[model samples]
Target chain A: MKKIIYLLILCLTTSIFYSCSKDEPDTANSIFDTSAPELNSFDQWLRDNYVIPYNIQVKYKLEDIETDYAYNVIPADLEKSKRMAFLLKYLWIEAYKEVAGDGIHFVRANAPRVMHYLGSAEYDDRGKRLGVAEGGMKITITEVNDLIPSQIIYQEFFNTIHHEFGHILCQTIDIPIDFRTITPADYAPSTWFNRSDEEAAELGFVSPYASSLPEEDFVEVLARYITYTPAEWQAKLTQAGTTGSELITIKLGRVKTYMKNAWKVDLDQLKAVVQRRAYEIQFIDLDNLGF
Target chain B: MKKNSILTIILSLALAISCTPNIDPIFEKSASERMTESVENVKKLLTAQTNGWLVEYYPEKTQKYGGFNLLFKFDGENVVVRSELEPLRTDSSIYALKGDMSTSLNFTTYNISLHRFSDPSLNIGGGIGLAYEGDYEFVIVSALETEFILRGKKTKNTIRMTPFPTTIDWEEFCQQILDSKPEYRPLYLHVNGNDSLWVSNDETSLTMSYKKDNVEVNKKIAYMFTPQGLKLYEDFEYAGKTYSEFILQSNNNLISAGSTFVPRVPPATWLPRAAFAGTYTLIHYTNIGGTGTPYTKTVTLTEYDNKFLLSGLMPSLNLDVVLDYHFGKGILLARQQGLRYIGGNSLNLTSVTNEFGLSPGAFYIGQQVSWDGVSDPIELTWTDYGQYGSPIIGFVLWFTNSAGLSVGQYTTGPVDQRLWTHIKMTKQ
Candidate 1:
């Protein structure tokens, strides 16, 4: 009877300790300010064109944190940024959207989250970094100062976009496993620059950089095929000769099959749209962001 | 054992009761609140000024590239900037005062006029991997109504922004400062009477060099031009005095804010004025009317400031041959020097030697008819009297331009006298 009474007292002592504290949650506003800023007309245009449909942010106003700290570079020119943005949409974005049929959804799903514009090219000890992409999320395009309304002038930019977009698609859905086996011995991971473009093409590679890795090779082939005209593509095959051309044709067929099966994109139809828009850029008013 | 256990239980109860912990915060606001307030206050101070702010911007960690002037005119989120490096260039961009590591004033947009310093363009500044290494984001160290102290985010160089004076036009002000750069080399920087620095500058690099311990010590100060003078990047401490500003004197010397530091040319005369001032005997040989006449006289040489005045060069007229003892060469009478100005024209000295023509030097002007210095310290090659009609080869009197010299301006003699003039002064 006394032991039972002591146990009851012990329970009472623990119950007394719980009475002072309340279980109420905090009502104070958050320390972080998440309020949407009043956007300028250009920013509003960016929102309507890019963010609304694709959820991408095109930042011409350079934040030092957004750029590579190691590489010394400057912010993109405003006029140049407008020109490049309009050109990118006209050539790269619209091309994929029109032909892929479902690629409009594919791009909306896999497009870069952020695109940074730089006025000067980011140069290192070896040479210039034309464009840099990180983890299929962000893409920083340099040489905005060199931007012009011409097919030849903005070729590197278009190639870089297609190349990086190809990477994004491949990252989301892996490239064919057999694509690696086709040119297993031709890969030069470190000394790719030693081979000339013609030499690399003879080894069933599109460009010298494509010989760096199997993954790079797949993207380079996809990028070049989309950017190059039929005449240009044939000219490359001519340089490759019969044995080289046979190997390249087999590789390109696999790549085309992979794009059709994995991402549902047609390479030939995409090129036609891209070329049509690439030609249309000569007439577009670059400085106008009114649309 | 029961008694010890009872005492321990009592002690535990007492300890628990005594430990009433205070959970209340000491300050009224949270850390975030304080940070937000600080950022707001800084923004207010930045845009408070009516005119603008003058920035003393130093690029690179070591400040090897020196400093430049960047003027900022802020209106809300917009900021317009101008640079001394490219005087005419003005670029407008957006800025933000953020609650980052500190309240950092970030130049968010591309300011070609200003951000070129930080750009690796391969054209401006250093090329490729090398750049001016300037900073666009400035961490606010302190903020006040009149001044805001900032530290570069990357370079960590201290940058000061003060209210831009509304007195002068920006272009003319910068032009005046650039024009005030040391026109000659080996300028003297006087710290005081005893301690001094022999200063030389490469204006292209904007670097000033001095010799210390027989080794060259270079200092590059980022400067801003005010109406009166230039302000240094920071207070320069040399020989127990701190100099932050320099005022341009009327004599083209820059005097430090403390009045102790002055960078100027110490008088070019090698010897003192007293050393060159004394009476002398004048010897002259005049060949006029085809007859040579030896004329000797007792002349007086007296000190006129740092120059010397001789009374017997042309004895017939009341003329004092003012000789400037300068250029580290004894008594350098440049061809620009004139004498006896009558109306607008003056009778100037035309001394010539074949080996060394009238290139400005401290060669002796003598009365000798020969090349030997033993006869007279000064000598000239006298041409034939026949050549006087064409070029006038010998020393002859002609009314030259009083203002200065031009190539063929000294064509005809206004005064028609073909007088051969020479002077010899023997210091006694």
Candidate 2:
């Protein structure tokens, strides 16, 4: 009688377990989609060049989730996006490749994971925003649609890329201690915008924004040195006059040495490569990117 | 005993099953499935109307640019949009239904008409950081076969859309609204069988004025035209009637939409001379010649010879002048002025006519002050007030309220050779 009672209790428990554990509905497809997006020719080019090589995602399509909700920004123009992509690859990526010698390794390691392109400048209450780099992972480039393949505009944009990249490089390996001490007394982070570039240069800084802090001063020197021609740089230094020019020269020397010792990269050689690529852009037919 | 125990177990199991109550689902599908279905339903409704839809979009939450009309055609993943923005062109762009907290319609590609409102460089709505503070992503609120309501994701502005009839010519319809802009003049609001409201446009905005307890109550709002009519940013309500839109009718009359109780009547051909009699302060002055900054001065217009004559001491020039004008024709008659440099040296000069070689027969005033209630009635004409008619150009005058001026501050000149000046004055 005891054996029969135990058997009946076991049967009831097993039946309850079976009823409760009926197979959950297959929600894999409903919850998350695994299909890849349909890519146009431009997207395919980005995938082949930037994505496959450096693992960088070029977001030309304006995704609200990826943007600063505070801003009212529009998507990059398809034509402009294509041109800018090619230009960036040639001027920024390719130039860095030549500079580092190990073309793929340098970018694959230090390059930002994401690059966002905006058609218009992200203007704020204070002023117009050019570009921003966050956490060494994402770099947002604004005013992409305004590119006209001109030398001045090209240098303006390339300077921003180099400036942001310089920050990324510093994040990987801290900025040299010597570079910070060069202009330790002149750093005015809050009121930097009020000062003109000439005034900043006179105060031993490369640009007005450089006077904001030691890190900014360091990157400004690196970016301005690479983008400016030898004559343009000399003119800037000459305009700095006397003690201001001497201080800028000392800061720049420290930057050059730091790049060489720390990253094994020659600053002058990188500038030459970047300048050569920039000149090559004028000849490329932007309308037809014969991919 | 074993059989009895088994029977008890069975009875207990049946009792437990009967004790528990079953609950039914309110919705037939899962939440995710319902969300997907709602997205599809919205998309279907949008694409159902083959002729496309017309949208009245208010980009700014503050309603700075008022409302703009957009004609949109959705087919597959593409959308063709048209508006009255610069270049007046149509563009085909990509669009998608993206799911966030709710399903949203996003213009994935750059459309000139849609993107201009978001371009900060354009500064359409005049705020910094965000141009016009508009939104490209709109959450689907509700939709019917013929109409839909969408709320801007960022701006929180409500956009109303209705299907465009195939018979309506979109371009012509938009052009007609643009063509209906009234000539710069005073507008009157006829309400309660009385022309009690004074309306004016200050080039950038529309202002309606009425006396409330002996104090001038002015309500100024920016406005834009739609296919149906002119829409004011703020609704004008009086006597239990609210008006935000007006349908254009014959004879430059605007009938309030949905009601005939309030209508905007055009200004009379001529205004009474008493309308110009007031003490005004020089609030703004500009010299196009890039010289001679305007100093603050008070000018009083007194009714003279059945017309209005401006009498005042020019503070900058130290000259006493009296000028007469025709209120109806907006003409400034030639006037002679007594000139004397005050302070250091006193050189009393004689009065002269054709003082600036201004064509003798009342140089048809380029810009004249009118009581049309279209703008500040104190805005005087752009006249040549040079010394000895030697083209030592004088400033143009704009006036506002003298006692506790509420408008903006005074401005100087980046003067041009043509001597274009703008001045603001206030009535005391």
- Give the lowest summed-lDDT range of ten residues in model 1 chain B: B361-370
Write down the TM-score of model 2's second chain.
Answer: 0.54
For candidate 1, write residues A228-262 as lDDT tens digits: 88888999899888888887888888889988888
Every candidate's fraction of true contacts kept comes to 0.49, 0.53
Best candidate, TM-score-wise? 2
* Weakest lDDT window of 10 consecutive positions for candidate 2 chain B: B341-350
Error of 2 at B97 (Å): 1.5
TM-score of 1: 0.69
